[model samples]
Target: MELEVKPRIYVVRLGGDNPKLSTALKLVRLGYAVRIHAKEIPPHSVVLNPFSREILKPSDSALLRRYGVVVLDTSWNSGLEDLRSMVGRRRYEQRVLPVLKAGNPINYGVLTKLSSVEAVAAALYITGFKRYSLEILSKFKWGLTFYELNKEYLERYSSTKSAEELIKVQNEILRSMGLQP
Candidate 1:
């Protein structure tokens, strides 16, 4: 909604029947420029990590516009382990998404821990592709619900001009939720 940058999207799937994978499939079906990799991904792509301390914000949009976006698809319970085992072997600009409420069945209304689709959508939203994000979510029944639940936080992160400002806002929200930031 902010800019017209259309960078390619890539998903490194680790064999999961999860919503994240479902969303990735939907993204591919929707004619979005998406590449699915079951093995190692390209080193130049900007990767998303649930364990990273670097909260993604509006400032990262330019980088994504230039290098594209990458999401690692794995099971929620084994996310860190899977990412570490798989991603640790590669070099990527890893970043975490800002705080958002989950709308998925397993973790609905929960903070920060988003499903694969939600994480990708959040990144897309913060990086000036709000419409595209919504479009991706539209493929599923709960997609709009996820967007509505985290709309405020998504907008705030998307509006931030710098990573520091985004981090400050993210910290405030997390603190209010009694979450360890």
Candidate 2:
């Protein structure tokens, strides 16, 4: 009998604004994620970066399983600056999630404005951890709704075998929504 090794999930908390509404802290409390400092981020791990040029795809599952995934928790106001500071220095594999609507009350229906947990779940789902993704999202009342809002996109993104294919699907989706790809 072998115990299944759960892939590590890490959150780098740089934004202390509105701690009460922070989804990243909630994840730590629920034991679904671990809180670590920016400097502690593992090398070659997948770091969710909104400004990243690389798109996360199913092909990254093996890497994720071996190196783990990370989500940078920062306020929208300081997000870009926070990301910029960490982008080039760390040997992290930064990835950007394709367009997806937010399910959190604060940013509901807004595209690509996901909470920390939502971003983590999206990365998990895209990396072939669908069941684990749903598990984490189930902890929050609006978490599952995130999946509901972007089910079609999530499904299509997860089905892609490579980043190029994933980008193609995402472009088509954007075009269909009348948004420039």
Each candidate's TM vs. the true structure? 0.85, 0.94
Which stretches in model 1 have alpha-carbon errors above 4 Å? 16-21, 38-40, 86-90, 178-180
**Per-residue lDDT of candidate 2, residues 1-181 (tens digit):** 1114457899898884687788988988888889999889899899999988788888888778899999999898766788776665558899889888899998999989889999999988877788888889999999999999999999999888788899999999989888998
**After best superposition, candidate 2 residue 104: deviation in angstroms?**
0.9
Can you list the residue pairs that collide in candidate 2? Answer: none
Name the 10 consecutive residues with the lowest summed lDDT in model 2: 1-10
Candidate that would win on lDDT: 2
User: How many angstroms is residue 7 displaced in model 2 relative to the true structure, after the best TM-score fit?
Assistant: 1.6
lDDT, model 1, position 174: 87
